[model samples]
Target: MDRQTRSLLAHADHPIAAPLDDDSVGRLLTRAVVRDDARVLDLGCGSAAWLIRALGQRPGVTAAGVDVSAEALERARRAAEEAGVDGRLTLHRGEAAAFEAPHPFEAVLSVGATHAFGGLLPTLDAALRHLAPGGTVLVGDAYWEREPSRWARETLGEYEDLAGTVEKVTAEGWTPVYAHLSTRHELDDYEWNWTGSLSRWALDHPEHPDSAEALRAAARHRDEWLHGYRESFGFVCMALRRTTDT
Candidate 1:
């Protein structure tokens, strides 16, 4: 399936689009958005779900999100309006790595989007460019909970174990102020929702042009998750601050 189609199906059931429960998301946002009247930026902010939630919880916060998907940005715009935070949110359609803002934000978020910048450290580099001094970054990415099989490594790319993952960021001059390792329930929930949402869409719209493709894609993804990476793959989200002056 195409990227847009995959994204639409993947996020149909879960707006956060990661293996994180609502409570976890709320806690992470609370840690990341520490400053009063904070300005926040989300790179590769898919549908801007995080920003919408943050803006809703904290009226003094303003946010901007950049993503390459016009469709996703439209969804974000509509969602923000529904939440009555459209005035406090801005959406930009562009490559997040290439996006530039006029002013630095107090908090930068790039959850589950390190792939857009090639890897975790590069994503942090991008966030650093747009971050104010003493600002925090909220980043999330996959890790290896155990030594992965060759197929799993090839499928998901190589990642360090949780400790090594944290070491990498700290070595790059960021300290993890708070972190969350997704529980087994959260991981299974995400995969189930991802596959189920797509499968349901296909079942509901059997006559649609992409129905067959969507069904096949969903089945393939479900199989891959159950057999390919279920035992070893893990996800971590961290609220990080610079360890030194940039």
Candidate 2:
């Protein structure tokens, strides 16, 4: 998919009317186990909505966001200002993979962003590098179908391990990347938004054959997911606690 965040954000269904992805993000942010002075840096923080909301509502905390897109960075800055969080939040336009905080980070968050990593090592290495001692991490990512649905296996592209990076870090080996958070429950959290967003993408991208196909595949995939995997209450949530050792 294109890296332009506006294009990505424009079509996604948010739990709120604002720029947020869903209520799950807010819940995770609220439950972040951090002290008032804890420093945070959000990776791939598109528009910095998560950072803004967390810093805006929480007191005695400072947060910064990093992203590769200049446009998204600008939006994040503006969002911070609009939310009255400019004093507590900063945004940097840089590649998150290489970005580093000037100070040790008490917390690092990446929601719906780590899918960029196909392997677990790369993701854990990145996360562990930024984490401060005894810090907490909240990791929520896309749910991969136990078996790819018909349309998903066909037109939705490859069946990627969206949650693999988190799993490999915490459960598999290489000194877990922080503690495990509720990954299982968070997977279902995006169903409504994903379905609505993809449907919108299909309707708006009538001329873009690839997008049109992607949206179609998304629709079919959602139906299959609901029938095959979803619950009446929606998603599953995991809680991960970070360890002192690396």
Candidate 3:
């Protein structure tokens, strides 16, 4: 499937595009956006769901988002208009890693988008580039809850354990001010929603040219999650502050 097709199908049910519940998302944004008039930027923002929520929660905040997908950016623009925050929101179509903003932001978010910059640390580096001094960075990425099998490692890429992941961040001169570990229910719900939504789309649109491919992709993804990484994989989102220059 193409990037647009896969993105639309995967996010059909879970608009956040991460294994986070509504409450968790609210809490993380609350912690990250301390300033009422905070300027927030979300790199690899996809459909900019997080930015929309942030803007809604803090009416004084202005936000910007960067993503390579024109389709996703269009959806974000429509959603922002519906939410009545389009006036304060800006959407950019480009690579998040290389996006250049006119000014730095008080909060930079890269949740579930570390892969866009190669890895978690590189994602942080990109966030730092656009972050103001004393600003907060909200980043989310997967880790290994248990020892991963070879298949799991190959499929998901190698990840440190939760503690190691945090240590790496701290060693890079960041302090985790708040953290949320995705619960079992959240993880399983996300997986089910992803596969079920895509499968349903394919089933509902049998005559579409990409329906069969979408179905196969969904099935293959479901299988990979269940047998490849479900038991060992974990996701964590952290609100971090730069403790020292790195």
Clashes of each: 0, 13, 0
Better candidate number, 1 or 2, judged by TM-score: 1
What's each prediction's TM-score? 0.98, 0.67, 0.98
lDDT of 1 by residue, 7-45 (tens): 777788898989999999999999999976999999999
lDDT (tens digit, per residue) of candidate 2 on 17-58: 222345555666666635778787777787777787778667
Query: Model 1 — which ten-residue stretch has the worst lDDT?
Result: 1-10
Reference-based lDDT, residue 47, model 2:
78
Q: Candidate 2, overall lDDT?
A: 0.60
Q: 1-246, model 3: which lDDT tens digit per residue?
A: 696768778888899999999999999999999999999999999999999999999999999999999999999999999999999999999999999999999999999999999999999989999899899999999999999999899878989999999999999999999999999999999999999999999999999999999999999999999988999999999999999744
Number of clashing residue pairs, candidate 3: 0
Whichever of 1 and 3 has more lDDT, that candidate is 3
Range of the 10 consecutive residues with the lowest summed lDDT in candidate 2: 230-239
Q: Which residue segments of model 2 deviate by more than 4 Å?
A: 1-23, 119-121, 150-167, 172-239
CA lDDT for candidate 3? 0.94
In the predicted model 1, the residue pairs found to clash are: none
lDDT of model 3 at position 14: 95
